[model samples]
Target: MYAVFKRELFSLLNSLMAYITIGVFLLALGLLLWFFPDTSILDYGYAELTGFFSLAPFLFMFLIPAITMRSFAEERREGTYILLATRPLTDWQIILAKYLACLVLVLFSLIPTLIYYYSISELGLPKGNIDTGAVIGSYIGLLLLGSAFTAVGVFASSVTKNQVIAFAISVFICFIVYTGFDAMSQIFALQYLESLLIGLSVNEHYQSISRGVLDTRDLVYFISFVALFLGLTRFVIGGRKW
Candidate 1:
């Protein structure tokens, strides 16, 4: 598992894909937080990262798929998947290793944005009137959200040998999981059903934590979501060899 993890990480860093994904994330973050003047701008009286975190999910919908698109799809396309399958690693190990690699890459891209916190602090009216607790909570929610999306992408990649199809499917699935539930709630007739639908959405839980609530239910929802997708990915890959 460790060897596979290292190899996956090394391959991602060695490729242009990693750089391009990170570059796009940073560019979007900068534009939304700094360049685009709106209510959340530094000079607009909003010291918190409300706008930044709000934009994170949409950006990650594309970025996470880009990172995970080639995880297994490209290997299968190149016929290296057979070689990997013959190795001593179990399907779960392989999936976990690849998932960890993608998670690390996503987290690495996020670390640089911490500078935005300091920038806002220095520029605030009272030298840091920003809601630190909410910022931290939002970052945690963003990480969990990204992890779930990565798992979904990995599962999508495992189902197909074509990277383009994997990317498309991953993006579509992530979009659905992230926002589909809320949309469904609007169309539901029963109030109970509508409430349940909204509760199932990634965005709902994300918004709860983003407000600095740190609800145990929200944390569990994210963990369960990621685990469910990762388990499905392992099952899919294992069945392929049977």
Candidate 2:
């Protein structure tokens, strides 16, 4: 598992596409947080990272899929998965290695944004007046959200041999998981089921955590979401005879 993890992570690091994707993700966020009129923090006159936190998840819906689209898809398409099957690794180990590597790339994209936090903190009216607690909680929520998306992406990749198809599937699933539930909850016909629908939505839990409250229920939901998708990936891979 460790060896597989290293190989996958190193491969991503060596790939120019991975770096370009991360670069574009960061660059977009920077532009939104600083230059965009409607969403810019400076224009809003607030000492918060609301712009970043709000825009990030939408960007992630696309960014994560791009990162994971080639994971198992490339291997399967190139006939390298047959070689991988000859290894001593178990299905779960292989799936997890790819998942962890994608997640590390997500982490790399996020870590650089901390500079925004510091810049915002210093730019506050009274200096360092930003809501530290809420920012921390939001970061926590963001990381968990990224993890769940990575699992979904990996599952999408495992189901197809084409990276483009994998990316599309992952993005569609991510979109539905992120906001479709909330939209469903708002349906007049589903009013009775609103609470249940909202409970299943990723945005609901994410918004709750964004307020700086650490709720175990929200944390559990994110963890379970990741596990469920990863289990699905394992099931798919295991079903393949090769």
Candidate 3:
């Protein structure tokens, strides 16, 4: 597992892909947080990252898929997947190694955002007046959200040998998981199922946590969601296919 994990991570970091992706993610957020007129913290005159937290999910829906699009597709294309499998690794180990490696890139992108929190907190009139709980909770929510997206991306990649298709499917699935259900619940005909639909949405739980309140239900939902996708990825690779 460790060997696979290290190789996966090294392949990403050793190339320009990881750096470019992280740079793009951070640059987009930085502009929104400080330069964009509508979303700028300076324009709002506030010490809050509500803008960052709000805009991040949309970006992640794309970022994570791009990262995981090659997880299996490249290996299969290069005929190295069989080679890797012959290395005495369980299917779970392989899945998890790739998942963790993909997730680490997301973490790398997020860590640099802490400077935003610190800068915002200090920008307050009296200094350090930001809502620390909300920031902490939102960061936690983002982490879980990233993990869930990574799992989805991994599963999407496993089902196809085409990287572009994997990215499209992953992005679509992530979208549906994040907001499609909640959007669907808005139909006048589906009002009866609104509660259930909202309950299943990442946006709903994510919003709850973004308010600085930790709920065990939200935590469980993310964990279960991630596990479900990871299990699907394992199942896919475990099948007769490559």
Candidate 4:
């Protein structure tokens, strides 16, 4: 697992793909937060980074799938998955290594965004008037959300040999898991069922956590969501295809 993790991380860093992915992520966020008209932070006339947190999950919907689409898809396409499976490593370990690799890249992409927080702090009328606790909570929420997306992407890749198909399927799955539950709740006629459905959505838990409260249930839900996909990836990789 460690060897695979190192190799995957090395491959991501050694190529221009890593730079491009991070660059695009940062650029899109930057433009929306600071440059674009109407939606720009400057126009909003507020020192808080509420806009960033609000838009990040949507941006991640595309960016994360791009990063993980090749996790297993490329290996299978290039016949490296056979070589990888020949090693003594278990299927879950392999899935985890790739998942962590993509997660590291996601974290790296997020690091630069701290500048947004700092900038907002300084721009405030009282200087450093930002909601530090909420900001921290939102960051944690974003990480949890990103981890779930990464796992889903890994599972999508594990089930297919085509990166494009992997990406599309991941985006669709991520979209559904992220928002489908809430949509279902709205459609359901029973209030009790609606409440249950809402609780199942990632956005529901994420928003709850983003309010500077660390609920164990929210954390557990996120972890279980990630684990579910990783487990599915392992099951898929354990098949004859490997």
Per-residue lDDT of candidate 1, residues 29-140 (tens digit): 7988787776347656767778888888999999999999999999988999899889998888899999999999999989999998998888887998888988999999
- lDDT string for model 3 (134-216, tens) is 89999999999999999999999999889999999999999999999999899999999999999999999999989999999
The best candidate in terms of lDDT: 2
Model 2 lDDT tens row, 183-202: 99989999999999999999
Number of the candidate with higher TM-score, 1 or 3: 3
Q: What is the C-alpha lDDT of each candidate?
A: 0.90, 0.94, 0.92, 0.90
User: For each candidate, what TM-score against the reference?
Assistant: 0.96, 0.98, 0.97, 0.96
Give the 10-residue window scoring lowest on summed lDDT in candidate 4: 183-192
Show where candidate 1 strays beyond 4 Å.
188-192
Q: What is the alpha-carbon RMSD of candidate 1 to the true structure?
A: 1.3
